[model samples]
Target: MLRGLIASGRLLANRATTQPARLSRNLVTAAGPTSRCSLPHTHHHHPVAAVPALARGMKVRSSVKTMCDGCAVVKRKGRVYVICSKNAKHKQRQG
Candidate 1:
């Protein structure tokens, strides 16, 4: 039902208003439209932030933590986390 609503655009009603909150180009700071601004060639555009090239290598475990090479089971914020500093690939969490 939730997927159907999202696909039908009903769940996206709030997204239309939230897009400006993460806008890459700021209208208030950027130069006005070319037709209205006197300096049409001098547009004040802000550089977009570069995205980090990282990978999502987390696993969702059905049980709490693992006994991997260096995994440690820990409880935090009412949730369970399995962190492995030596083998970061074996990191996972469950709640």
Candidate 2:
């Protein structure tokens, strides 16, 4: 009796798993083979030459290599921007 119960339980579990697959198949047929909502019909065509002009021939500045000197904030004409280790850590914590 215990073995029979275990077999029935497994059969029920298998049927439940198969139910979702059958439901998906029926939904696909009803929607039509070409009109699947999960898959996008129209794909956006992106430009092959999507590279920025600056990236083509950009010279790296030595100052920009170690930008802000590991400090959280820097004042260049009194305009503040997040550019350091502490600032990044602080931003992540805030988020």
What is the C-alpha lDDT profile of model 1 across 1-95, one tens digit per residue?
98897786964777876777656345534655443433457767899989997875768777865767688888889778888878767778783
CA deviation > 4 Å runs, candidate 1: 1-57
Give stretches of model 2 more than 4 Å off.
36-95
lDDT of each residue in 1-95, candidate 2, tens digit only: 99999999999999999999998998889889889556556888877987665422222232333234564434355444334563343211111
**Candidate 2 similarity to native, TM-score:** 0.35
Q: lDDT values of the candidates?
A: 0.71, 0.56
